[model samples]
Target: MVAGKPFERWRVAGTRRRGLTVRLIGGIIPIVTLSARQNAGRLRQRQEWQFFATTFRARPGLAGLWWGIVVLRGVLPAGFAVAMGVLIGAIDDGAPLVAPLALTGVIFLGMQVLGPIHMALSRNMGDQTAAWLYDRLTDYCLEPAGLGHLENPGLAADQAAARDFDLGQSAPPLRLSMGFIADGIVSFVSGVACALVLFGYVWWAPPILAGCWLATHWLLRESGIWRDRNTDEVRRAQQDAEYHYRLAVDPAPAKEIRLFGLADWVLNRFVLRRRRLHELQFEATRLRERSVLLSLAVVLTGNLAVFGAIGRDLVGGGLALGAAVTFTQAAIGAVAIAFGGLNWSLDSAAAPVAAVLRLREPMATAGALPAPSGPSCPSGPTGSSGRPGSAGPLTAQTGSGAGELRLRGVTFGYPGTGTTVLRSLDLTVPAGSSVAIVGRNGAGKTTLAKLICRLYDPDEGSIEFDGVDIRRFEVEAWRAHISAVFQDYIRFEWPLRDNVAPTGAPDDMVLAALEAAGAHGLADLDTVLAKGYPGGIDLSGGQWQRVALARTLVAVRGGAGVVLLDEPTAQLDARGELEIFSRVLAETRGRTTVLISHRFSTVRMADLICVVEDGAVVEAGSHDQLMRANGRYRTMFDLQAQRFDEPQEVGGDVLA
Candidate 1:
């Protein structure tokens, strides 16, 4: 759980042993078509090449090592067969047993020792490569560029597949591909040697082996298709299992489920999904059992034919017992190894290819967006020639003082929503000013604050810093001069110092800001803040709000020119709200401030008040001006001010 360790690394390592165990268990079980037909597609040649190049590039050393091991492994088995055959021929022909027996035992022992070493090394290397690939894919998915692409459901599903796919199968594919090439070479050499030896007796033995191999190859190709189809079904089942688990465990729905006594209903839904998975698995199992039985039948029949032919030769004194025994053992071992290598290669290639394709989809889409050029001022009145006024000094002068902020003709919408949240809103504040935005729910007050902070860009119009267009500057650079406490502000699981610091580290400036914001005594700055863990503490809503305010003050002290407070006192009592605001006003003199609130008392203190309704600025003026005019602002102010005496609920009407 340490930062920057990458989630994929932990998942990959944790699941690797389990995946291999599953494969081994499945290997022993009867062959079933566990793959789904939906997964099969015409392989793209370009993609194939890209997959090869990328895998090789990522693990060039491992690739070379694996290839060498495969070649050695393949050659050793054939060499052992030839040595055994020579030793048997000599013994049968009345040669001394000591020399031949010693040489034959040494060769067999060497092959046995080397086989395990090769398997161990290849497995270890494959695991390392899979881990590295998983990390790379995770990084690609998490990059800022991929954010927009994640909105696509298809892309999200593909990513989910990649993450959920078993990476333990990764090593098998790599090992099998190399193993196949090596086995093919060894098989060719052994076939030629056997043909030369058997031709003296009968030219038909080599041809029969070749025919059996061709027939098995065809069967294996068909089996590969079935396997891929079954894999898809299993993947779907896994997805369903995860969905059921989430529904059962998620916090948001727990209360509703408990209230309605729907525990059995949720459990039944989970059971139904799992039952479907079990049924699909049963079908796959049946199919695999049949396939294995058929394969074994073919293998046994082929061996019988060879044995029958050799028996005739022995009866005629054409071949010795030891020679026939050694040939049969070596040939059968080679055939079994070849089939295993091919099956592994064909079945294991899909997941890594799918992962790479999924990653590329997001990366390509992100790359196509138009790059934001150099900082260009966002279009606004401040940048226009009509407003040639210098609002105020750029930095803090001496004593605390309020600053000014002006917004002109701003319009904005959430991305892809096709509905404007704020439209043609204009407001202004003079130096040493504090303004509150007040309106009913969906009044666009929160939207206005976000636009000011540039968390998003305006669809039309602009926001200004002093007399300059804020958009013209680098986005981060402009944000550095603004401090905002959002309604949905996140509370990070870190020490209090980080929660209040200008950035992540503690500084003298952070301490000054925390004191000024009236939040310094909540807890020791060194105290770690996290929930549901040893030594972790949870803060109440009010205390968290205070900490949020402290975060903004830290930003302000670090040279933020503007401060946006969105419902800063929503969690506080009336007295606490007044005290916090009063301290903020006193300590943040000379700094421009925009406050968005439902409380009339909080808004009335502002030098300018703006009333937003239905995404437009319906009224704007000083608090006194608006109240005297008896406009939209006046009606809302009066309605809220009356709440204190009426003993009515606060925020009820405004929120409604």
Candidate 2:
């Protein structure tokens, strides 16, 4: 019996020491500071609060309401604990139970009743903030004047990341940060209250408990990253897997994919490849979960020791009944607050926040060109109004405003690839003439056309209309007078009237343009071509080509000074292509028309034919002149003609 007494005393001493340890080291354990730099170098300098500040500034009233709710939610536990402690303490002191019971009942009921209302308010606030982030980021992306960032690979990836949040493929950054804010404040405030209660029993207990909480939060956050990781294999596997997946789903490959019967094979490949890509991330997440659970285990153990010390005093006639209830709940609250929302918000915000921050630098500097004059191209801005903006380009006629187009030392290259596509090549398109430019693919025909349209500036040259540099005039003002039909063009899903009359041309004018382009029976001006409309009618590819042709003709008939057709019939069948070219050429006789085509039949009718080779005009003349010259144009034309005339043969045997 004597030995048992000493052993019991030793056990009591050990428990006291453990309790004392928690109080002394409160928050002495370090917090894991999450730096944006860890994700991408550029994100390190970004302000994560951009979303908050923008929303707050835009809607201060809403912001105030949100802030009030979060703060109240944060300190709810602390408020409840203080009120409960008062009620219990009064009872222990032998005061009347009625007032104390009434107060406690009110406090308990308010918490339960207010929970749902508080949650709804919180959700509304999050929705407001998230919506602001979406709109602000979206405006920044689309407002750029240039198309460079839109097509760049690095910026494109950032765009994709940002769009994921817009499309809800990922968590909103504001929502994540809110969880970090609201839940983290709850945990901290409640924890501080608990530690303060522990302070009365032991001077060291509060600090020790705070320290354990900090350590638990930090350790759980970095458990997956507490050790070194190999990432190369993961990234490579992911890229390979994504490539296979894209090939299977992308519309560009749909025809070939079915022809090759690759549906099942590629689908199976995608499944296997996705597994490979996820291998490392899955393992890391699992490891982190294990580490968090393990940390929770240690924290609960320390908590049990503290609770035991307090419970012993309450039971053994050394502690007041009110103090016992407060201390017991405080210990549980401390642990509960420690595990609440800090890690989740921090982790989830990483991707979207990184995208938001990194995108600012690239997108801000893009599209910095001079603002467009207006939405619609103003009529006769160049000389029609006796001013530079009036009839110079848009209202210019062949002899009156439009003159010879001259290129001087023109040079250009695609973005990211510095290899020059156009060199120091000079050419002229005389006014009141029909000119045809023919070349092999990538011989700079398309680039030349784009330069004329001023989609991109020439690296080191000037293109002049009417002896004045095209750049001196506003870009859209100059382009407004030039009607261009490109090889690849959109067949818009709208009414035929809307498609042909984007400038809101009159019904009579629209009918005239349609008739000129040989699109008589396809659709009238009022006919809707969209599938979803009340009376929409679908048009075939050939019919659509005719519609696009009519649209171009409307621009020309509207007094466009110059007409450009770049392989306009490339998508049509051979006979349809030939027929359309013949009609358009006949329709554009007196206007300054520039046609780009490979088919010699189309080129044969041009007033002047120019052969482009290696970014220079190698030959120029009428058909008879070019045939006598026997240069690149003549050779190409003969080769095409010969193919049609010759009989098919295999190994010196003609096919029967």
What are the lDDT scores of the predictions, listed in order?
A: 0.63, 0.68
Mind giving the per-residue lDDT tens digits that candidate 2 earns over 1-656?
A: 99899999999999999888876664343222233335454453444354455457546787777667656655566556655776788877887778777777776776675555555655565667667667767777776645555655545545654555434333344543554555655566667766777676667666667767767766765532311112445434545665686788786688888999988888999888767655544454444667677777777767767877888888898877777777666666676446654344543454454465567767766544444354453333543322112344345344433457788889877666666888887878888688889989989998888888777677788887767677766655677777788877677778898787675777787787788776886776677887668888888766777888888887766666678888887767677777888888777766678899888887787888888888877888899999998788778988888777887798999854
Segments of candidate 2 deviating more than 4 angstroms:
1-47, 54-63, 87-134, 170-203, 223-256, 265-301, 316-318, 341-350, 353-357, 364-366, 370-401, 524-528, 532-534, 649-656
Global local distance difference test of model 1: 0.63
TM-scores of all candidate predictions against the true structure: 0.66, 0.78
Winner by TM-score: 2
Total residue pair clashes for candidate 2:
29
